[model samples]
Target: MPPEDRSTPRARRPLRHLRAAWPVVVTFIRSWGLMALLVAGGLAIAYRFVAPPPPATLRIATGPGEDSAYSVAVARYAEALRGQGFAVELVASEGSVRNLELLRDRRVDFALVQGGVAEAGRGAGLVSLGSVFFEPAWVFLRRDAGIGRLPDARGRRVAIGPEGSGTRVLALALLEANAVPADAIIASPLAGAAAAAALLAGEVDAAVFVSATPGQGIGTLMRAPDRAMLVDFEERAGAYATLLPALTPVRLPRSGFSLPEDLPAEDIVMLAPAAALLAQADVHPQLVSLFIRILQAAHRGRQVFAPEGRFPSALNQDVPLHPDAARWYERGPTFLQSWLPFWVAVTVERLWVLIIPLVTLGLPLIRFAPPIYTWQMESRVLRYYDDLRRIEEEAAAARDRAARDAVEAKLKALDTKVATLGIPSGYGALLYALRRDIAFVRDAVRTLRRG
Candidate 1:
């Protein structure tokens, strides 16, 4: 690049006399130090507060609506999130296993995952908003099979669930606990409506339905034309719950599905695992908070298992809760959060951490910088004044003409230097005063010469 044209720019006269030894460094600090500090502080606060805006839309992995509670609940969450200016997109998947996979791969922002899908541990990089609802283990068998207990299905063909499903996981665990030989049962890969269809068609002797909420498939099985009987887990419900830390004991009241028709003959005891709202660890905190609020509005009611306002819970979650969700659960909302708009409140909360420290340090600097800069400029004038006084004293004591002439030469040199000294126009009075004193010394030296 060609050199910049300084020729036509405003001319700055050279300040040789008053230039300090470390002029560039000292001049820059004195001219722009405070402004640079203020600009940097403002930018720091902006980055902390506004860099991660709430996403306009988020994709969530939910299970097929025909058979999974996740589908139903996710739709409700989508509605709630939309009302708050967020677009919630639903991506249907196989089940909790696929949901976890989607979250880990970053294919989706959120997921409704069943507890205990974390065989070794919660999928890497995943965190939860909270447990939303219980997924009961519902087992159904042919009415004539007369199978009253879980162990009785040892030799009978059973449809666990499809590949990569939490239902398959729980079913295998339960049957294994009953000592049912894996080789003895015809475990099918069919899940959801397919599994229910297979059981009704007599392709499998029984089917196990594991879902966070009651889906159409479970309801279809119960109301099947062949009258398939729902196997009561009464005998082994507690045992299953005890063996599986994730499972909770639940009682499904008789005819809860159809009060007048009395769908089931008696109350059924079962073990169920709760489904949690999960996200990646690095998801924006503001988005997490917004997700929690949507979860709250969508889940603030009595589920088939839990009491009203008991869901969206932080405690006892299978995965660790997102930090923001935990804070919301522990302390409702912050002060500004309660009064101001959500974005405004969040921006303030995020900035205060940086803003508070800058304010604490900046006030002292603002008070002291100007005075220190003034003292530096004044020292230049004082040094010249001291030199002039020494020259005047020597001139007054000189007895010979040669000595007075040398002192006069020194006075003229000092006068020339004072004339060239540079300072802001505001200090013009001080500059003029020093020149007047130099003239006085010059006249005294001439008088000594004449004497």
Candidate 2:
């Protein structure tokens, strides 16, 4: 307690400020206490919508190999993700059936799956990011076989692709729907370039290539010119769609598969299923949203079979859209894409869900805030002064000792009440000043008794 230290401006200033600031501080503390649980619970609920960081690398099951468009599309996705600091590992599989199996088992992070290969048993465990491309069932035949349509190929050697491909699943389903007896057709396991080679070598009567348009097999068969002809679905495209809900009818121009040479002399109608990007149910939403943006960039624009921006479509059966994708289809990309960089946009978008509600509450809370503070400072503590004035007035009018004694008792009780009051640490200066004022009133009563 040095005299110079006590008199220092800094020391006195804080003490004076503390006394002035207590009511504001206490008012805030009380207000915050009332809202603490609500804010905490609301934030906890908002946290559920926050997506986790995308993985450093992702493993996706693509079809057959690099020659296949499914595989090529997956490779493009890998390249795009790589530029964004994420590595996408492409795993070659038999085809759509195998992709579905891998996704069901959670063996891979993502897959290039053919539509309609997914079975109900594992349907709940997976979701589609949207169809990225079309896998058209291209049936190329030897001109001499006289195969004008699907039924004509019966009893002819047909290579629909090997065991588990989406090609095989779709080919068989279409044949069964067309009422082509299974016993009449000789189905071969050869697929891809092998199937195309078989038909060219005269080893098979017809080869069915279920591939993304402009397949290597189709290009190879195009070299045959007049010898190989595309079967026409003609007006039967809608019939096929009506018969099989999963198949979408599409028309390809004479040279849709290859531009320079008119592969087919005229337009031919065909059925195809979209090749979708599918993932396990637990896949991170950030990665789902990230992949869709990248894939849309990769799949958008006109292709041989589909119109520009026709793919990455949410319209498919057998599977639901991934939640992120449903939002994507409804909202048309994350809102942050317009102004911010990719990474920053994703982070902000993830937090934006929480920010909305907090902002909504904060505006009204701040707008109506003055009354609460005024009551804390001007009314609560100041009411003690009014009580003291009433007691002084009663004591002055006292005609007998009993009334004066009652006023003294009330003052002693009031002093006791002030002494025992509990308050926060920051309010200590105000509490100290209040006690000093109470002491002054007690001294005045003491002097009245002596007089």
Q: Judged by lDDT, which candidate is best?
A: 1
| Residues 229-287 of candidate 1: C-alpha lDDT, one tens digit per residue | 77777776677777778888788888876788786557877788888988988888877
Query: Which segments of candidate 1 are over 4 A away from where they belong?
Result: 1-57, 79-89, 192-194, 224-226, 370-451
lDDT of 1 at 189: 79
Report how far residue 90 has shifted in candidate 1, in Å: 3.4
Task: Tell me how candidate 2 scores on lDDT.
Answer: 0.75
lDDT per residue for candidate 2 within 184-275, as digits (tens), equals: 78999888778888888888888887877566677788778677777777678878888887778778877766667765667888888887
How much RMSD separates candidate 2 from the native structure?
Answer: 6.7
TM-score of 1: 0.71
What are the runs in model 2 whose C-alpha is more than 4 Å off? 1-57, 85-87, 119-124, 257-260, 334-451
RMSD of 1: 7.5
Candidate 1, after superposition: displacement of residue 144 in Å?
A: 0.8
| Model 1: colliding residue pairs | none
Q: What 10-residue stretch in candidate 2 is worst by lDDT?
A: 1-10
